[model samples]
Target: MTTVSPLVAAFRQASYPVGGHGRKNIQVLKEALHEFDDKLESDIYGTGESIEGFQAEMAAYVGKEKAVFFPSGTMAQQIALRIWCDEKGKRKVAYHPLSHLEIHEEDGLKELHQIESLLLGERDRLIRLEEILALNDEIACLLIELPQREIGGVLPPYEELEAISAHCRANGIKLHLDGARLYEVLPYYQKSAAELCALFDSVYISFYKGIGGVAGAILAGDEGFTAKSKVWKRRHGGDLISLYPYYLSASYYFKQREPKMGQYYKEAVELASLYNSCEHVATLPLVPVTNMFHVHISVPKEKLEPILVALYAETGVGLIHYLRESSEGVCSFEVSIGDAFAQIPKELLKRTFERMANMLQ
Candidate 1:
């Protein structure tokens, strides 16, 4: 028998609204698994109709000449950078300091590809046009993340992004988009997916993040670029024997949930507004530019976790399952609005935070 932590137990037993997807019940898991049953009659390998269908659909949707599926965004991004570096004969790539490549990849870019990351702009802010203008070093590519995830889903102004794109083009530097949450952020920009991808030489999108797939990523670019990426995907051992499950789930969710992102973004803004009204709890960025934002609480994690657990135990509302502590003793957690969030009433959400704030007092 395994022992469940008190916090985990609280989350498991709660009946009211909780964050993001609400712990995938057995029924939900079965439903997702059944998607594979339908796919079993189709091609099983990476070479067949199922994988090719997803790739073609994604390419057309992103306005790329081609799209290649990969097992993970980390592999896709690293390979994209490697391709650009090899083509440009320059090893440097520029992106924000908080980029997944810089912080999460554990220096794989430097160690594996000998790619030098030129950190651009200040942390917790959008990379500005002036930063691009100031870069004198010859670089392979400029990678930009829409709704920059690390900084509360912040995005640069549309004009600034266009200027940066133009600058990169004029300077003969390639541009790649780390659009893991691209679908979620599209409603705010009011631009079609293709319009946005048109500004970049390459774009990488995660099937799991916004699309709610089990796992996979798509790299979209020109046919030549995608062809090269396929070779690299094989080299990186990302070429799975069969990708039907990932493709089927990705394709299914892309159709079902992608259209609802605008509603999610609207709900996020409304929810954040409610948080701002409470004491000791605030939404980072004050306004959400996308469907995700961070909630910063004035309580330390050690103190806050118990409160969350207690609240859930008493009220059946699991407000937070976990909290990340900052150096200043404040605790923060990300709130990503999706289908689960739609079920939560705005008034109840407001009351929950109000209760949390009152408890702190």
Candidate 2:
């Protein structure tokens, strides 16, 4: 039922793909388990070393009173909103139009919990502070996705984030951060994880996203808030009998890649700059705020596909996996810098982009 575009098809065939830390193969999981003990006891019903210990570590990492691991961000985030709605005696929550809850989750929030969504701001832009200020809706929570993914991974100014957090607190609105790619933004903001988290009432971060782990997410908040989450976790069947693999990979990569975010950020700027210099090609934001940006090409998908295929074949540098049409004939695809970018040869990169420019012209 799933289809792969020619761009992705070619990118997959390229030997020098310029994205991701590495192949998401058995090797990735193998590296994470390299130091882990085989005789270690696995967690049961969310207890023991792998589960609870990692939860506590993450709680400290994000400067929260408590944290709980979940099988997916979807389950963790829905539970977060449900708890706030119950406490505030409201069933409606607010977030950007492109929020994962609104666009991706297929109405799980509405169907499962009877919670309604009050969408804020337009789809093509980040939610402005003024939009939150004008909100007269009696919503229980306001979710802000840092570096909103759907819109080229753009972030609001840090001052705006502070103001939004203050406004939410003053008005009794629980501000939730959909920080799926939280660590990726820290370098741009020049702030610590705890400092950024202090502004929000609840935070949900993913391990498989920018961290490049197998798969898992953690929801962090005050002890009281987290206690309520555990109850909902059981109700949602989020607790597997054992999830040591996800935990191990998450912990290993979190330690391995957390310090490299600054380097990735710099590489993203460099990559975006090269992308913008190509004829008929540009990047959203004109530069990157984090390790990701959208490469927009002023060409239709049908015509662009062959160019990318040839580009990958000739240069062996697969820049992106797919294309998404914006309006008329313009199309785009996202690029997130990771360990692979640094491994690419500098001379090869120059010829790759230069050839890409010449080809597009």
Most accurate candidate by lDDT: 2
Q: For model 1, how does the per-residue alpha-carbon lDDT over 70-165 read when each residue is reduced to its tens digit? A: 889999999999999999999999999999999999898999889999999899688878889776538889999998999899888877878888
Q: Rate the local accuracy (lDDT) of all candidates.
A: 0.84, 0.91
Q: After superposition, how far is residue 174 of candidate 2 from its true place, in Å?
A: 0.5
TM-score of 2: 0.97
How much is the lDDT of residue 110 in candidate 1? 94
Native-referenced Cα lDDT, model 1: 0.84
- Candidate 2 off by > 4 Å: 1-6
- Of candidate 1, the 10-residue stretch with the lowest lDDT total is 37-46
Q: Give the RMSD in angstroms, all C-alphas superposed, for model 2.
A: 1.5
Runs off by more than 4 Å, candidate 1 = 1-4, 24-29, 33-45
- TM-score attained by model 1: 0.94
The residue-by-residue lDDT of candidate 2 on 31-107, one tens digit each, is: 88887888889899888977888999999989999999999999999999999999999999999999999989999
